[model samples]
Target: MCDTKHCTKNNNNSRNNNKNNVKFIIREATKQDCPSLKQLIIGLAKYESRSLETLPNIEQLEEYGFADQLAKRLFRTVVAQLDGGDGDNNELIGYALYYRNYTPSQGKGMYMEDLYVDSEYRGCGVGRALVAQVAKQCVDAECTSMEWLCYGWNTSSLDFYKNLGAVDIQESLECHKFGISGDDKLAQLANKTVDQQSIKYKIRTGVRDDCPAVREMILKFTVDVKMNLNKVVTLDQLRDDGFGDDKDSRQYRLLVVQLDDSSELIGFAIYYNDYSLNDGKGLWLDTLYVKPQYRRSGVGRLLMSRVASEAIADRCHTVCWGCYAWNRRAIDFYEQFGAINYSLVYDLRLFAIDGPALKQLADCALQ
Candidate 1:
């Protein structure tokens, strides 16, 4: 039951502890609750020894959370109110915030971003109720797991989470938090003051003719990630999957970067159109790779810029991609473009439905 405090590993359980017959009403938050939520957030900051001035303002929260059009909400929240509970309180006393995340491990996940129960209402099941609701949402979303963070010194909060079965991944994995290091958006990148050598690279759409070169780079890319090349894909298969004229069969697009002088391919990006009913249209960066010799030469940035430009052209709401945990250089590169890294968030679990598993599952379904 958590979102982002640093996206560390999380403990998760699916249980509802409302057996105490609490009188509070917990429901999804709306515009009317913004003020209450804001006040709660400020109180939370002060409790954590921080100040309200450091957080987003009401107008910003409204725009980002409740705006009808062009809303940039990063999380969905639910608030706890009263029906016949303590003092017959109808005021918002507690809230929980969560958001969806994805990583190479956990294909998709939900992170509970914030949860707070009013001081007056503490120990009255309000906090547990909010968390139970968020956990329910985790199941509704079919997320791999739920994750969040807590202050190391907050023993009470830590105990509450431990009771919920959350594991501290930070103890084992080096936790690193990165914010969007660049102030520029996709459209602004091309015009930004950049390396002089960037002008000499050509970013262009890839076609069937480039599949061979693309495949060779794919081999090197796999090896660079320390992943074994289990099987090599032939150029014909690559074309059929990406460049085929049969629009129905083609599922991905490719972009290749080359030196304008020598026309040598140095980097590549493969992507596809992906949509979520909740998020509308988004572009998935499947693979991004640069030749070993091209490292630190700005080729990687050039390829990413073109990929982003294409995403903007398609009106994609966001671009999604993942990098290896050990690939600090690539992570830093992406931060320059405002990519939120969720690698450490939640327990990453990828399910590969292999041939035997597919057969076994199919066998379970009766005709």
Candidate 2:
């Protein structure tokens, strides 16, 4: 609930500084902000030309974001409130919602689920201040990166984020986003029966002992995707993080595909539950990889099917993942299940900051 006040030039700076001055304070959102937050969510949805029908109601929002139960609170939010010196005039102008995520290579990370600034206050640095607050939290939490998605067509926002030291991963990493949403579609996909060829394989939940195989496969997956295996997690850390005594504190869930005859691991999918203002409860598929030899044997789809099945059981609204645009095989496989190519339809691109850039951005926040 700490407040950070910022002053920025308003449209009417020519007037006496004391009269038309525009200042705002950024602070963590509280349960009481849910009503205002819900309205802002609607404004954002309309502005983005997205539907609001599927969004959670205000009560659900309170439960999902500010409930007493840690497991029920899915994300954290920071808001920008107008500060007119007169406390009575304070008005919420914008907010940024985010949640924690983990990357095998980067460890702890943060993903911004939603960011919106009222159209009237667009250029007053509110958005920047809100993001800075989130970035500061990233450093405080020892996270290695902060990531979000932006529509490629929104050049203005692209430049805004670029100025904040973020890089569009679509351009930098050459990856595109995709998602499967709607209960009907998710249910249909969850019911899919993987057509395993004559070669037999079994998909099962990974355990503590599977860390060694999982780590090896993670390296292979990184190389296969032509990405550097920089700062990858160690075997012990992976095992402890995923299979720790506190099950509720696990970072990610695992599903592995094993050869039935040899009991050898051939593929794995790493995913975790996620929540967003737009999608409500959802699942993020962090990494899904199949050994080269097992590529066409339906192991990949089996893993995905299992992921989708679990998501549906939990009543998740969406299941999302990213893959390189050049990976037509992967793209085609996902399309078979009615997954929408958000990158293609909405021109969305993933953006991220990590390593030195992230450190620099974090340092930019006021001490």
Candidate 3:
């Protein structure tokens, strides 16, 4: 959480001299800030030329992000406000919204859903302060990385984030997908069930007892993809962090496919709820892997279908994930289920900070 008392503000001579010595501080947003936040969200939409038809109403925003009845808050919000302003008249210049995401290779991470600064306040370090606060919070919570998306055409933002040490992952990978899982589309995919005669497997929610298998599959998947697994990733961490006492507070949800005959775990998927200013709520499929023999056997499709169902059940409107450009088969698989490759359509790029870069950013925030 972004504790207000400890939140920092930029007050260097350069910032103090900018635009009539404008002063600002970044702190966690409260329910009272929803209205301003919504306005900023709309402003961002207009800046991006995106439709506001899908924007959440103020009441929905409050409930989803600030509801008192929620077991765990859906997302964290921070606002950059003009400092020392009159009481409730303080002007909010920017905001950042983020949530938790987990991967086997990155034990825990933060996904920034929105980072917007009012146009008038751009170039005053308000955006930088908001992101620095989020980065600090990530480090405080022991998260391993922070990730977000950037429009390819937004060279300014791309440069701004790059200066913060964030890496454009799209340069190394192919693209990311936002699967529009409407009810009709979800039904069509789920209806394409696997061929039971060829492979006897059942998909079910995973439990702590299955952590070992999940860990094994995760290592195998990393190896198969020729990617390095995090040295700190561990089975105990998966079981403890993912199956904690407060089920709602778990980092990620698991679904595993097991052989009905031999009772072997052949495939698994790890997805978690995520939110964006534009997309509202969605599911991010961090990992979906099946054994080599199970490729083209409908196992991946069945797993994806379940993911779609889970999204609907959770009232999420989208399913998101990334794929390597060279993985033609995986790309075809996701496309068949209505997943739009945003890299092709919108030229969107994914950015992330981890390892030494993450440490440096977080350390800078603390100072």
Candidate 4:
């Protein structure tokens, strides 16, 4: 017969140990949790060693948590509450804040705004649980993919994100504010100051006649860049091929960037609606390039702003584009304009299969 007393004592010890272990529950943040949320934010900021120049006070927290319409519409904050078990006082342990960031080219993708865990909960599964929650939220919102940025110095975060299949786009060069700041003072001077006479810009729908010039500009801009221009065709060819006798080809629209005074083309964008299995309806910035001399003269910004407005007018869910990883300037410019990088296309290739046998082999390899 088994020793009942020993077995009972062991079971009791196991239950006691389980009770002492950290346990947490995650739920949607309520307005009442604003104080706890604020504390958590402050703790996170302090832990990250950020300057308190923009720290949120109690009043600001109220405005942000309960009153700000824009903030509410843009993000959803979920809190993780640690329960000591047996109905003890629950404390806010961590948070995951995220919002919908759509990629026009890729369909409906989302990006995480912020994900932070308390220092005490660092080694626990709290962070992973928060990320998992955010991902589920993205899927529920019908997002095709999710992305976020991790600091380069934070190797732990980088490794965690990579483990979660996140790709870093630091390799893309983002040339930004070209003429506005830094050594590009000349580019900045191109824009008219408040006292100076403002230069007007003209925007119009591109036509077939503008194809040759636009294509030439694209070729010049991408001279040494590693980009696939297969779908980037001349305006005339696009209209002819896309809307030709066959009604099955993809549909596209073109916008031409021009100077109001000279009516000369500086840049153009080719875009189309993406209706794929993963994404519903998104806009792809197939090509956007301006003359080097005309850059930082408000030409790029004007074109991008107009494109965003046009995308909104067309009821597009999102707009998507890609830039080289080393292009910090371009990345900053895009981010300032509210465009976020939610996905990275890697190792893009262009190929032509000559024979049916080769095509079959390629398909098999893909599988």
Looking at model 3, report the run of 10 residues with the lowest lDDT sum.
Answer: 8-17
CA displacement after TM-score superposition, residue 306 of candidate 2 (Å): 0.8
lDDT of 1 at 331: 85
Better of 2 and 3 by lDDT: 2
Ranking by TM-score: 3, 2, 1, 4
Candidate 3 ranges beyond 4 A from true positions = 1-20, 70-72, 85-89, 364-367
Per-residue lDDT tens digits of candidate 3, residues 68-154? Answer: 865546788988887655665478889999988898876888989889999987876677777877888898889989999889999
Using alpha carbons, what is the TM-score of model 4?
Answer: 0.52
Using lDDT as the measure, the top candidate is 2
The regions of model 2 sitting more than 4 angstroms off are 1-20, 84-86, 195-197
lDDT to native, each model = 0.62, 0.81, 0.81, 0.54
**Model 3: lDDT to the true structure:** 0.81
Q: Report the C-alpha displacement of residue 231, candidate 2, in angstroms.
A: 2.5
Model 2 Cα displacement at 38 (Å)?
1.0
Candidate 1 per-residue C-alpha lDDT over 94-148 given as tens digits, one digit per residue, 9 for 90 to 100: 8887665432222344556578888977776667667767766665554445666
Pitting candidate 3 against candidate 4, the one with the higher lDDT is 3
lDDT of 1: 0.62
The true-versus-predicted C-alpha distance at residue 270 of model 4, in Å, is 13
